[model samples]
Target: MREIYNELKRHSGKLTEFAQVLVDRGLYTNTKHCVAMMRHSTQFRQDVQDIYAEWKPGKLKTKDTATHNAKLAEVFRSIKKKELKEKVETMCEILEETLMTVTLAIKHSDVRKLGEVKANIENILYGEKQ
Candidate 1:
């Protein structure tokens, strides 16, 4: 049970880090940005789901232990909820940043610059920094 809690805590921390990364590099306004964000979101969700599934079994098996199970359930629920909220907030921040980048690029008469920036940002976000 302690091990399970530790795993949940680790995953939650990773998800929080991923969200922060998304928020930090919210400057893509082209195909790269869209693709990178999509991939990141997909992977993050998969990771969260996997962690939840792992906890679910333990939670079920220990249902007879109401106090222990209830504590586990509460931790699971709280962490998952906070992870989701952070995900949404970070996603929105990314979108807003992308839109702002596009607007600025178009206004400055630099469409090509926008594309370059977008691709670079995507590379950074997706860890394809080559």
Candidate 2:
């Protein structure tokens, strides 16, 4: 149970960082114009905010995985811009891979492998060669 909670907490942190990348990339905005013109306008900002809120460090010690997954799916579905949507979807893939890597590391008790996975995740997220 502790291992599972740790893994979930790590993934949540990654998701928050990814969300910031989206904001930095202009994929998330407080601008009403962008929100209004975008599809699923009503849920856009709030969805992003909810993700950030729920995933903040020290906040996921006891969260329901199913609920978290559902919220993430909704946020992805709310993205209407083709390019931004693709980027977000790609980020989602990265997050899934990171989660799997963490789980595997915990299962095998492989600390070195966990470090490698973390580095891989960073490279993927930042578009850096490693």
Candidate 3:
């Protein structure tokens, strides 16, 4: 749980701490609602188990990414292949750009931009040019 919260923090600052607090409160509120619903509705109680199933894989993914990224960073620090380093650096930039763009698209409900991102990812993965 501490690691999970630290992962949520992602960076150090008072604002980040405040953000965590806000997230905690939001979760608390939603959990209370869920409990109330569960008491009142059989469907809500049964349906909530699926949410846990979905979240379990995501939690594992979060931990796995942290481990994977640390190893990648370590490898990059010792790696002697300039070409591989340059390619990895370029890929990192592409990933950062995609992360930001996809986040903004989802936040704004921009379906068209999301579709474009899908095509971009496909092109990158399959060696197809737009």
Measured over all alpha carbons after superposition, the RMSD of each candidate to the real structure, in angstroms, is 28.3, 27.6, 25.6
Show the colliding residue pairs in model 3. Answer: none
* lDDT (tens digit, per residue) of candidate 1 on 1-130: 2333344345435333433433454533454453345444433445434544653553332235878889999999999999989977776677677777888888988777687667745854674664
**Distance from true location, Cα of 72 in model 3, Å:** 28
User: Candidates' TM-scores?
Assistant: 0.39, 0.34, 0.35
lDDT scores in order: 0.56, 0.60, 0.55
**CA deviation > 4 Å runs, candidate 1:** 1-64, 116-130
Instruction: Say which prediction, candidate 2 or candidate 3, comes out ahead on TM-score.
Output: 3
- Model 1 residue 60 lDDT score: 32
**Top-lDDT structure, candidate number:** 2
Q: List the residue pairs that clash in candidate 1.
A: none
lDDT score at residue 85, model 1, on the 0-100 scale: 95
- The Cα error of candidate 2 at residue 59, in Å, is 69
Ranking by TM-score: 1, 3, 2
Q: Write the per-residue lDDT of candidate 2 for residues 1-130, one digit (tens) a residue.
A: 2222234346545434444544665766643433333333333355545544555556446778999999998877776567777978888887788889888889998887778787768866787774
Clashes of each: 0, 0, 0
Tens digit per residue, CA lDDT, model 3, 1-130? 3333333345344224333343454543454443343334433323234433444453332347888999999888777577678877876777677778899998998877887787767755676674
